[model samples]
Target chain A: MSVATADGLTLAGRDRRFGLLLTAPGLLSLLIVITFPLFFTLYTSVHDYTLLTPNYDTFVGTENYQEALDEEYLPGSLWVTTKFVLASIVIEFIIGFAVALSLHATRRFGSIYYLILLAPLLINPVVVGLLWRMLLHSELGIVNYTIGLVGISPVSWLGDADVAFWTVVLTDIWHQVSFMAILLVAGLAALPREPYEAARMDGASTIRCFIHITLPLMRPVIAVAILLRLIFAIKTFDIIFIMTKGGPGTATDLISYYIYRAAFFGLDVGRASAMAAGLLVIILALTAYLYRYMNSLK
Target chain B: MRLFLSVVAALALAVSAAQAQTIRILMETVPDTRYIQELLPQFEAETGIEVEIEAISYIDMHSKLVPQLIAPEGSYDLIVVDFYWVGEFTKAGWLMPLDDLVERDGVDVDVYVPKLMDLVGRVNGVLYMLPFYNYSMALIYRQDLLDDADEQAAFQEAYGMELRVPQTWDEYWKQVEFFTRDTDGDGNRDLYGTVIQGQRGDCISMQWANYLYSQGGLYHDENWNPLLDSPEAIRAMEYYREAVEKYSPAGSEAYCFDEAFNVMAQGRAYSFVTFNILYAGFEDPESSEVAGKVGITPNPGGGLNGGWGWAIPNSSPNKEAAWTFMKWAESAAVAKERAMLGGAPTQAQIFTDSDVVAARPYYPILGEILAGTKDFPVFTYTTEFVEQVGLELNLAATGEKPVAEAMAAAQEKLHALLVKDGKIEE
Candidate 1:
C-alpha cells in the first residue's frame, strides 16, 4: 500500500508540472502584454516624458501627482467624473431593475422583450454616440424638431453646458441599462419564490412583498449588478468622446477624457500616466471597499 | 563547410537588403487621391519598390502622428501632414532635414507659397514640409439674396456701408446683421444671419486663431509666455461672442466645422465663414440646395492669411515615394486637374492658368486671399496653448464668465503651462 501511494504522488506531481509547462506561453504573453505595460505606466507617471521629446524624459518624482492634485486639474475632473458615474449607475440600476421586474411579472412574449431590451447593450458605444449626436444637433437634429412641435424652443441638447451634461447622462443610461436588466433578470429567475408567495398569502401589498421578500433575498444579485455598472460607468470614454469630446468649456470633461487629452492630445505621457495611476488607485480602493462590504454582508 | 556557411550568409544578406527600403505614407482621405493614387503604380513600376498608404481624418492624423513621432522608432517612412502641424513636427526632429533632398532634386523651394511653406515646416531655419493643395479661408454667401445692388446699397445706407465684401471686422458683423433680416416677412424666422464653428475643439481654435491673428494679437511673445487676453485678443473674443449670440443658432456653442457647413448648405444660413475647401461641396448642386445661389469672396480680413501643408515623417521608409507623390500631387498638372474637377488647388501657378481659373470664376479673388495668408503658431506648445485659450474663450463667449476674468485665468494657466513645458522661464 505504501509503494502504491508513493507512485500516485509522483504521478500527480508530474501532471501538475505538465499543466504548468502547457500554460507557459499564455503566462509569458500575459506578463509581457498586460502586466509589463501596467507596471511601466506606473513607472512613467513618476517621470517627465512627452512623446514628442521621448529622449528628454527626467525623473520628476511625484511632480505629476502634485500637479494633478491642483484644484484646476484633479478636483474639477473628479467632480465631473463623480457626477457622470453616480448619475449613469443610478439611472441604469433603477431602469434596469424596473425592466427586469416587468419581464419577470409578464407571462408571454418574454424572450422577445428580453431581446429587444438587450439590443442597446450590444450596439457599440461609438455608434450610439454618433446616432445621439446627430439626433441632438441643435439646428438640423430631429430631437429639436420634435421638441419644437410642442411649442418649446429647441433645447441645445449638445450645445448648452447643462443640457449637454444631461444629454451625456441620458445617452449613457440608454446604452448600459440593458446590462443591468439582463443581470437582474438572471437574479430574479434564480430567486426562491417561497417568501414571495408567503408574503402574498399574508395579504401583503405588492410594494411590501417586494421590500420584505423579493429584495432581501436578491441582495447578492443587486450588489453584483451595482458593482458591475459602477465600474463600467466610471471608465466610460467612447460615448463622451464621440458626442462632445468633453466640450462646451470642459464642463463635460470627465477624468477619463482628461487623461485622454493629456496622453494623446497634450502628448504629456508622464502626466497622463500619473492621471491614469490616480484613477487606478481610486478604482482599486473602491473595488476593495465593495468586496469588504459584500463580505461583511455575508 | 566554410563554403556552405558563406553561401548561407550571402543569401541572408541578400534577403535583408531586399527589405531595407520600404516606405509607409499617411494622409487625409482625398476624393480621388489623384496625385498619389494615380502616380503610385507608376512609381512602384519605375523604382522597383513598394508603398503603403493609410488615410484618416484631419484630427485622427494628428493623434497617430504624435505618438509615432514621440517614439521615433521610424515605423513610417512618409506622411501627408496638414500645414498646421509643420511647426510642431519640425521642432520634434520627427522629420528628416529635407534641405538636402531639395538641393539634390534642384527644386526651387521658393516657388511654394511663402506662408503655407514657412508656417511650421521651418524650425530655427529648416524646411520640414511641402505645399500640396493650398487653401485660404473664404466667405460663402447667397448671391441671389444679394443680387439687387440698389437694394443692397439701400440696406447698407440704413446699416452704414456699400456692403461689398467686408474688408474689416466691423464691416463683416454689419454684413451678417443686415443679411439676417427676416426676408419672408413672416412671423417665423426662416434663416440665420450667419453660422460659424463655436465649439471648443480644433475648429474653435482655428477660427479664433484666424480672428486673433487678424487683430495682430500673437498667442505668445518672444519668450513664449502666454500673451492671450492682450487688448487685441480681448477685442477678437468680444467680436466673436457678439457675432455668435446675435446671429448664430441657439446651440452655436456645439457647432463644429461640418455642422456650420451643413447649416449654410441647407439654406438655413444667409452666410457662412469657413474653410475654402468647402467651396467644392457648396458648388455641387446635388450636395447643396444653394448651388447657383452660393457665392465666394475673399475671407474678410483685419489683415491676416491662413492655410494648411503636406509633410513627411523622419521614420517613413518610403521617403522617396512620399516626396515623389507630394511633388506629383502638387504639380501644376495635378492642381489644374483638381481645379477643373471642381475642387480648390493649392498652387499659385494653377490659380493663374486661364482654364483652371475660368472653371471657377471666383478663383482670382480666392487666389489673392491665399497669397496674403499666414500660418498659425508653429511652436511645440501650440496645441496646449490653443486648448487653454479655446476653453477659456468658450466660457467667456458662452456667458459662463466675464470675458476679462476668463481671459486672465486662461493667461495665468497658459503661463504656468509654458513654464512647465520649458517654452518659457517661470
Candidate 2:
C-alpha cells in the first residue's frame, strides 16, 4: 500500500506539470501584451511625458490626474459617451431581441434570413462609418434622395449639431445590432422547451410565457450580451473618427475621441494616460456593479 | 556539373545585387504620389536603389509618422511634411537639416519660390526640408456667371461695384451676397453664392486664417500674447461665420474641402477658395460640370500659404540615399516634368514651362500667389493652436457660441497653452 501511494503521487504531479505546460504560451502572451502595457500606462499617468519633447519628462505625481479632472471637455465628453452607449445598446437590444425571436420561430428559410441579417457584421467598422457617411449626406446621399420622393425635405443628418449625435447612435446600432441578434439567437436555441410548454399549458399568454419562462432562463445570456455590448460601445472610436469626427461643434466628441486627440494631436501622453486611467476606473466600478446584479438575477 | 555551377553562381550574384540597398518613402495620398510613382523608375534605374512608397491619407500620415519618429529607429527614410508641421517637426528634432546635402549635391535652393521656401523648407534659418509642392489657396469662380451681362448689371445696381473678381474681403462678401440667387427659377434654390470649409477640424481654421491675416490681425504678438480676441480677429471670425451661415449652401456647416469643391464643381455653387492643386479636379471633364467655365484669381483674403516638403527624419538609417532622392525630385527639370503630370510645381521655372502652362491655365496666377503667400505662425505648439482655434471657430459658425465669446475663449486657451509650453511668461 505504501508503494502504490508513492506511484500515485508521482503520477498526479506529472499531470499537473503537463497541464501548466499546455497553458504556458497563452499566459506568457497575456503577460507581454496585456499586463505590460497596462502597467506602463499606469506609470506614464504620473509623469510629464510628451512624445514631441521627451527630454522634458519629469516626475509629476498626480498632476496629470488633477489636470484631467479640470479639463474643459472632460465632463461633456463623458456625458456624450454615456448617452451614446446607452442609446445604442438599448435600441440594439430591443431590435436584436425581436429579430432573434422571429428568426428562431421561423422553421422555413431561416438559414437564408440569418445570412442576410448577419451580412453587415462582415464589414469593418471604419468601412461602415464611411459607407454611412455618404449615405446620410444631405446633398448627394441616396438616403436623402429616397426620402425626398415622399415629399420630405432633406435632413442634414451629419451637419446639424442637434441631429448629429443621434445619427451617430443610429449608425452604431445599424452596424452592431447583428452581433447582438446572433448571440441572442444562439441563447434562444439552447433553451429547453419544457418550461415554456408547461407555462403555455397553464394558460399563460405568449408575453407572459416569455416573461416568466424564457426571460428567466435567458437572464445569464442577456447579462453577457449587455455587458459585452457595454464594453464595446463605451470605447467606440473608429466610427466617430471616420464619420462625424466629433463635429459641427463638440456634439459627438465621445470620451474615446477626446482621449485620442489628447494623445495623438496634442501629443500629451501623460495627460491622455491619466484620462485613460480614469476611464479604466469607471469601467471597473461599473463592471463590478453589473456582475453583482447579474449574480443576483441568477 | 559545370553548367550547374555557372547557374548557381549567376543566381548568387543576382540575389546579392538585389539586396544591395533599399529606401522607403512615406507620403500623403495626393496627385504628387502618382507623379512620383511615375518618376521613380528612372531614379531607380540611374541609382540602382530600390524604392518603396507608402501613401496614406493626410491625417493617417501624421498619426503613423509621428510615432515612428518618436521611436529610436523609424521605418520610413523619407517623409512628406506639411507646411504647418515644420515648426513642430523641427522643435522635436525629428527632421535632419539638409544644408550639408544641398551643398554636397550642388542643389540650387534659389530655384524654389522664395516665399514657399521660407514657409516649408527653412525654419529658424536652418534648411531642414526641400519644398516639393505648393497648395496656395486661389479663388476659383464661374467665369460664365461673372461675365453674364444681366448678372453684371444686377450686381452693379445692387452693390455699386463692377461684377469682377473680388479684390478685398468686403467686395468678396458683396459678390457672395449678390450671386446667391436662383438661376433656374426653381421654387427650391439649388445655386448658392459660395462655399466655405466650415467643418470642425483644420479646414475652418486654415480658411479663417486667410481672412484673419488679410484683415491685419495676427495670431500672436512678439511676446506671444494671443491676438485672437482683438477687434480685427473678431471681425474676421464674424465674417467667416456669416459666409457659412448666410451665403454658403444649406448644409455648408459640415462642408470640408471635398464637399466645398464638389459644390462648386457641380455648378451648384458659384465659387470657392481652395488649394491650387484642385485645379486638376475642376478642369477634369469627367468629374466637373463646369470644367472649362471656371476662372482662377488671387484669393481675395491673401490666400493661406500651404504646401508640402520632403524631409529626412533623424531616425532614418538611409539618410544619404533619401537626400539623393529629395534633391533629384526637387530639381528644376523634375519639377517641370511633375508639373506637366498634374503635380503642383514648387520651382518658379516650372510655372513658366510651356507644356505645364498649356496644361494648366492657372499656372501663372498660382506662381504669383505662391510668391506672396503668408503662413501660419511657426511654433512648436502650432498644432494645438490650430485645433483650439478651430473648435471655437466651428462653435461660432454653428451658432453654438457668439463670435466674441468664442474668440475670447480661444484666446484664453491659447494663452494657457503657450504659458505651459514655455513660449510665454505667465
Candidate 3:
C-alpha cells in the first residue's frame, strides 16, 4: 500500500509539471504584452514624463493625476462622451433588437440576411469614416445630389455644431449596430420555447407572452450584451478621429480623443498617462461589476 | 580556418561600407517631397550614395518624429522641418547646427531668398537648416473675370471702385459680397463669394493669419504676453467673422484648405487666399474647372509665412552623407527641375527662371508676396498655441462665442501655457 501511494504521488506531480510546461509560453506572452504595459502606464502616471523632456528624474506623485482631473476641458469631454455612449447604445439596442426579432421569426434564407447585415461590421472603422465622409460631402456628394433631385436642400452633416454630434452618433451605429443585433439573435435562438407555448395556451397575446416569458427568460443575455456594448461605447475614438476630429466648436470631442490630444499634441505624457490610468480604472470596475452580475444571475 | 577568417573579414567590411554610405531621410508627403522622391535616382546615380525616405502626413509628422529624435541614435539622418518647429527643435538641442558645415562645404547660401532664409534658416544667429520650400499664403483670383469689361462697369457702379485685384481688406470684402450671386437662372445660390477655411485648428489659424497680419496684429510681444486683445487683433477677428458668416458657402465653417481651394477650382467661388504651394493644382485642367481663368496676387495685408527647411538630426550617425544630399537637392539646376515640377521654390533665381516663369505667370507676384508675409511667433509651445488659441478663433468665427470673450480666453490660455513652460513671467 505504501509503494502504490508513492507512485500515485509521483504521477500527480508529473502531471502538474506537464501542465505548467504547456502554458508557459502563453503566460509569458500575457505578461509581456498586457502586464508590462499596464505597470508602465501606472509608473508613468506617477512620474513627470514628457516627450519634451523624456525622463523620470522629477517625481511628481499624484500631481499629474490632480492636473488631469482639474483639466478645464475634462468635464466637457466627459459630458460629450456620456452623451455619445447613451445615444449610441439606446438607438443601437432598439434597432438591433427589432432586427433580431424579425430575423428570428424568419424561417428561410436567414443566412443570406445575416451576410448582408455583417458586411458593414466587417469593413474597418477608418474605411467606414472615409466612405461616409465622401458620401455625405455637402457640395460634391451623392447624398446631397440625390436630395437636390427631390428639392431638399443640402445638410451640413459634419459642419454645423448641432448636427455634427448626431452625425458622429449615426456613423457609429451604422458600423456597430450589427454587433448588438448578432449577440441578441444568438440569445434569442438559445431561449427555450416551452414558456412561450404555455403562455399562448393561456390565451395571452403575443405582446403579453413576450413581456411575461421572453423578456424575463432573456434578462441574463440582455444584461451581458448591454454591458459589453456599454464598455465598447465608452472607449470610442476611431470615428471621432476620422470624421469630425472633435470639431465644430468641440461639439464631438469624446474623452478618448481628448486624452490622445493631451499625450501627443500636448506632449504631456505623464498627465495623459494619468488620465489613461483613470479611464482604465473605470473600465475595470465596470468589468468587475459585470462579472459579479453574471455570477449573481447564475 | 584561414578561408573562414577571410570571409568574415569581407562581410564586416561590406557591412561597415553600407552603413557609412546609406542615409535615411524623412519628409511630409507634400508635392515638393514627392518631386524630391522622384528625383532621388538622379542623386544616387551621380553621387553613388544611396538614400531612403520615410513619408508621413503633415499632421502626424511631429508625433512620429519625437520618439526617434529623443533616441540616443535615430533612424533618420535627414528631416524636413516646418518653419514653426525651428525654435522648438533648436531649443531642444535636437538639431545639428549647420554653420560649420555650410562654411566647410563652400556652398553659396546667397541663392536662397533673404526673407525666406530669415524665416526658416537661422535661429538666434545660428544656422540650423537650409530652406527647402516656402508656403507663404497668397491671393488666387479669377483674373479673367476681373479683366472683363461688363464686370468692371458693374463693379464701378455698385461699389464706386474698379473691379480689379484688391489691395485692401475693404475692397476684398466688397468684391466677395458683389460676386456672391447665382449665375445660373435656377436661383439656388449655386456660386458663393469667398471660402473661409474655418476648420477647427490649423486651417482656421493659417487662413485667419491673412486677416490678422494684414490688420497689423501680432500673436505676442517679445516677453510672451499675448497681444490678442489689442485693437488690431479684435478688428481682425471681427472681419474674419463677418466674412465667414456673410459670404462663404453653406458649410464653409468646416472647410480645410483643400476644400476651400476646391470651391474656387470648381468655379463655385470667385476667389480665395491660400498657400501658394497649391497654385499648380489650380492650373490642372483635369481637376480644376477654372484652370485657365484664375489669377494670383499677394494677400491684401500679408499672408501667413510658413516653410520647410532641410536639417540633420543630432542623433544622425552620418551627417556628411546627409549634407551631400541636401547640397545636391538645393543646387540651382535641381531646384529649377523641382520648381518646374510644381514644387515651391526656395531660391530667388528659381522664381525668375525663364522656363518656370513661362509656365507660371504668377511666379513674379509670389516673390513680392513672400517678402511681405507675416510669420507665427514660434516658441516651444507654438503648436499648442496654434491648437488651443486656434480653437478660440474658430469659436469666435463660428459665433459659438463672442469675439472679445473668445480672444480673452485665448490670451489667458496662452499666458498659462507660457507660464507652465517657463517661457514667461508667472
- Per-model DockQ against the true two-chain complex: 0.66, 0.64, 0.62
Query: Higher lDDT: candidate 1 or 3?
Result: 3
Chain A vs native chain A, TM-score per candidate = 0.90, 0.94, 0.92
lDDT of 3 at B207: 90
Give me the runs in candidate 2 sitting further than 4 Å from their true place.
A1-13, A55-57, B1-20, B183-186
Q: By TM-score, is 2 or 3 better?
A: 2
Identify the leading candidate in terms of lDDT: 3
- TM-score-based ranking: 2, 3, 1
| Residue-wise C-alpha lDDT for candidate 3, range A118-196, written one tens digit per residue | 9999998888987887787776778888998998988988788889899999999999998999999999999998888
Residue B213 in candidate 2, Cα distance off native in Å: 3.0
Show what share of the native A-B interface contacts model 2 retains.
0.53
* Residues forming the 10-long window of minimal summed lDDT in candidate 3 chain A: A1-10
Runs of candidate 1 with Cα error greater than 4 angstroms are A1-29, A55-57, B1-22, B30-50, B71-73, B149-154, B181-188, B214-216, B220-226, B302-308, B342-344, B413-425
**By DockQ, is 2 or 3 better?**
2
Q: lDDT tens string, model 1, B219-287?
A: 777767677779988887877787677788878777788888888888988787777777778888888
| Fnat, one value per model | 0.64, 0.53, 0.44
lDDT: which is higher, 2 or 3? 3
Evaluation by lDDT, superior candidate among 1 and 2: 2
The clash numbers for all candidates, in the given order, read 15, 0, 1
Model 3: lDDT of residue B329: 94
